[model samples]
Target chain A: MVKHCSVFRDKTELEQGVAKMAELRQRFKKVVLKDRTDYYNTELPSVLELGNMLDIAYSTLIGALAREESRGAHTRTDFPKRNDEKWMQHTLVTKKDDTFSLSYKDVSFTKYEPTERKY
Target chain B: MKIDLKIRRFNPTTKNGREPYYQAYSIEASEGMTVLEALMSIAAAQDPTLSFRRSCRSSICGSCAIKINGFTKLACSTQIIPEHEKAHEMVLEPIANHTVLKDLIVDFDPFWKKLDKVKPYLMPPETQPEGRTKEVHISEKDAEAIDHAQKCIMCGSCNSECNALEIEKKYLGPAALAKAWRFVGDVREEGGRKRLGRLSDDHGIWDCVRCVHCVEYCPKGVEPLTAIERLRSRAIQEGIKDNHGAKHVEAMVNSVKKVGRLDEAAMTFKTLGLLRSLGMIPFGLKMEMHGKMPHPHLFPQIKKIDEVRTIYAEIKRKNKNAKKKPKG
Candidate 1:
């Protein structure tokens, strides 16, 4: 799954990653039964952890989809330029009710601000 | 590439519950994949019931500590490539000295209890006098001294494999003493003298056996044994040297200086004093009967006794100079 997530090059790849995560999440819920395992506040530890992993994976995919410019370690074959004006702020993704909500938060700039990657 | 991971599995609710056993699963390995990433793969695809504790896969949370091939390490930080390079089969076990709740999950209550002994939090800074408000600032050098100790995430990896804790259950293990050093080294703590006094009490810094297991196993570079030694030195410097542990160390050093070797009788007499040593005569006689006691009368001087004395003298001179130098 992580290998599949890493091969994300464009919007379509990220969407596929999200779909894969959603399928994995559903299978995890069905396979890990609650009756046999120990419960803390009506949730099995394994199921809870799987949910957390799914949340993290889905949010990462959503972040990759929103950031149009190729910046930092993320390389987008479609959008190859660093668009500082539009994609300068940090991308924050929150999943609520099976929906990934995207929001932009201001970057706290110190002395060093974003610049063109010389490499 | 595929590697076989033999994981120790336990489920308390099973028919033959509470009996721990190993179960092997073949998982695909990729470049830059950690042991933790592989475990997650097994958990997701092979068995959703597989359990482990983890947060902050970057290794900051310190929750993913476990034993790989009998060595303590954080699972997330340890790469599977090296283990795969060594052999086709890999072993996974929960860390030693911690009670396992289930597969890969151990109870952290004992670890946290030991940490609570150090008074982990700092005492509140005194309020500004009247209308005079002055900002408190720490120099870069002072902060640097305690910087290494501050990196500890209380992962319990060091405490798990500690040999001293194996023998002395009540001992304030490495992680706690490292935490003590963090507070004691802070310049802002006005009650540092009092804190050192508390640390010198029973089951404190003196209890550490200096096995270096904590130093060897700490996932972070928090050298806990070194921190314990620092705490011991602070105790000695603050004139809080009433305990037998400190006296025993001082006695051993003095005996070595005098006889060019450890004079066990003299060390015992100095550490235990007259009455206690006299009372321990029968015990010493028993040790002699068991052939464990060294012959008291035959104290062999080292071939380089003069060289040893010279080294000691040089160290003392350097320490005296260090004490006399003005503090920045």
Candidate 2:
């Protein structure tokens, strides 16, 4: 799933990652927590956190697939240039139901306008 | 190379809930592979039930410190099998002087409790003039005193390995004391002698027996013992000499300076005073009966007693010169 998003995150790969994540999310329901005693039980917390992490991964993959631009970490081979008009905005993922909905918000800035990050 | 990794396992739900037992596993290791990696492999493939705390494969996180062959080390940084111990048996256990929460993870509550006693944060300056809200400058010498102490990652290696903490749990161990020094040495900190006064109390700065384990096992060379000594010296410099810690040191120093050796008879009187030392008469008689206690007035003169006074004079001269030096 990580490879699908990170390795070759074009439209096709990210779409596949989103699908894989959607499928994998259900399997967590079957995860039986071994350490029930809870004396510093890292297993229980980690498993519970995995659900949140999967949601984040799913959101990241969806956002990467939708934002077809070569911004910071989202490097799409198909669309290599930075998109300022449509894609230079925050992708807000809201989860009302089990499914997440993505919305766009304008990048708020005045003095330091969005430009290529120079070291 | 395959070496036997004996991990100490503990679970409250187990049949013998109170008894902790070691479970040995043969794990494959290579050159430069860390003890954390070995434990990771063991937990991953051999036994998924194995429990340990680990984060950030690098030593920066300070989470993966455990006993590697009875020595406290950050497992992430320490190699699996050290060169000296090539005979194949590598024991992995929880850090000492802490309760084991699981297999290799010790509960850090006791440690954090002591650490919290010494206010770990830099207390805000007493006054920040409203007009001047700029960064304050500290001399390099001031920063240098605290540079080594500030490097402490609070890995609890020093706390776990501390011999003093083993005896008295309340003795705020070396890690916390070093952290105390971190703030106390800061020229900008306004707390100043007030913090030292708190630390000079019972089970504080004076409680440290100078075991030096904290110095040896500190993954970063924080030299917590040195920090404790610095705190002690600072405590003395501030003329906070009424405390037992200072008095004991003063008594010893006076005895050595006078007789070129510790005069237990006179030193005890100086340290505790004649009135307070009344309680120690019984113990003193036992020593006196054994001919161990020197007569207070008829002191046996050591050879070259003036040599001891010379060292004391030199230190006093240096201290005078140091005071004369300009401050930032």
Candidate 3:
């Protein structure tokens, strides 16, 4: 229930962003209530609202998806294992013309050697 | 079980360009085989040149801390089989936020330097007796506090995970602050002010962004964030309000105490002390532009302010009770 205002260049862009977020929220609510699944199970929206309800471009989604294992706050019950080799790299999600792409970034091996992650 | 151990190695004397590179070695792991055991086997069988530090094989003597997989943990403590499910690969490297001395070894000088800055020793009120010093009696409650502090084995795991250290290199990370709290909370310590004063520097207590990374990473359950918060409260109570960061903390506390929630606009204004303080005016305007500015009239109220007050009061009461309880 967080709300924020963004200065849109034109009404159309603002409308597009709001509409997209509304649709995304509806899909999210549906998944939470009925499907018992997350956004990853279905098609991701072009816009994602983060923090105190500011519309973020869908660029962050690919990175989120690339992380197959659930760690920290990023929980994916379906994929509930830490896959180090495939998913160790940091996922970078970029946006270009209403589309999103996912890329992996290698973790700095200088200090921390990733070991058996146990809480 | 066979486990592939990938260890990062660096040789200082041998080559001009001895960049860090990974060396994978196969090791047989038993049911209770710790990462340290596997490492020891590798050193014994394959590579004697491999270097790392480990004193107490148990978690106590924090010398064997390193990054395993992607997290910081003591090699002596971490069991290997749980980490290796399918591929059976274990990546071992030095602790983060430090220069690697060699393979799996990091320079601990910087970490110890931060520890030294906090004056990590208790200074009691009365001097000890001549020749034979009397053991200062500590109650169960005070002993609990001391125990929490003493749990820190100086592993530097929290330091490696600290976000403040990532941004501000000079910032005194969690381990030192927790060490500072170990002294500050000690009822025997007569010079609490001196300890508080030491943490009042630029790269000291004020620089913490409250990221809670230290709290998350500390294996000892020592909440360094809580320690930092307690230190802030003590600092404020002692009337040490010179720095901008201290002033901001005070203002936030005041706002939270008065109103149930923080008045962000008021906090920003009070923190700067004036409308036209250098760089503040435009920053304030920029927030306003971004619609991030909170309206003073629209102070967000917590529904159960009394509940919060009661919780805080109960905590204070418990602390008082603990302090008053006689030593056994």
Best by DockQ: 2
lDDT of 2 by residue, B67-180 (tens): 888889999998866732663468888999998877888889988898899999897567884665567678787789899999998889999999999999889999999999
The DockQ of each candidate is: 0.18, 0.27, 0.01
Error of 3 at B225 (Å): 2.8
Tell me the interface RMSD of every candidate, in Å. Answer: 4.6, 2.2, 22.7
Model 3: how far residue B262 lies from native, Å: 1.3
Reference contacts preserved by each model: 0.06, 0.11, 0.00
User: How do the residues A1-119 of candidate 1 rate in per-residue lDDT, one tens digit apiece?
Assistant: 45545633677777787788878877866664533555221236655766788888878877887788788677777788889889888888876777779999888889997678886
Better of 2 and 3 by TM-score: 2
Candidate 1 C-alpha lDDT tens digits along B161-223: 899888888888888889989988886666778888888888888888888899998988999
Q: What is candidate 3's CAPRI-style docking category based on DockQ?
A: incorrect
RMSD of each: 5.5, 3.9, 27.2
Which residue pairs in model 1 clash with each other?
A: none
Evaluated at residue B227, the lDDT of candidate 1 is 89
Q: How far out, in Å, is residue B34 in model 3?
A: 0.9
TM-score of chain A of each: 0.77, 0.89, 0.48
Clashing pairs in 2: none
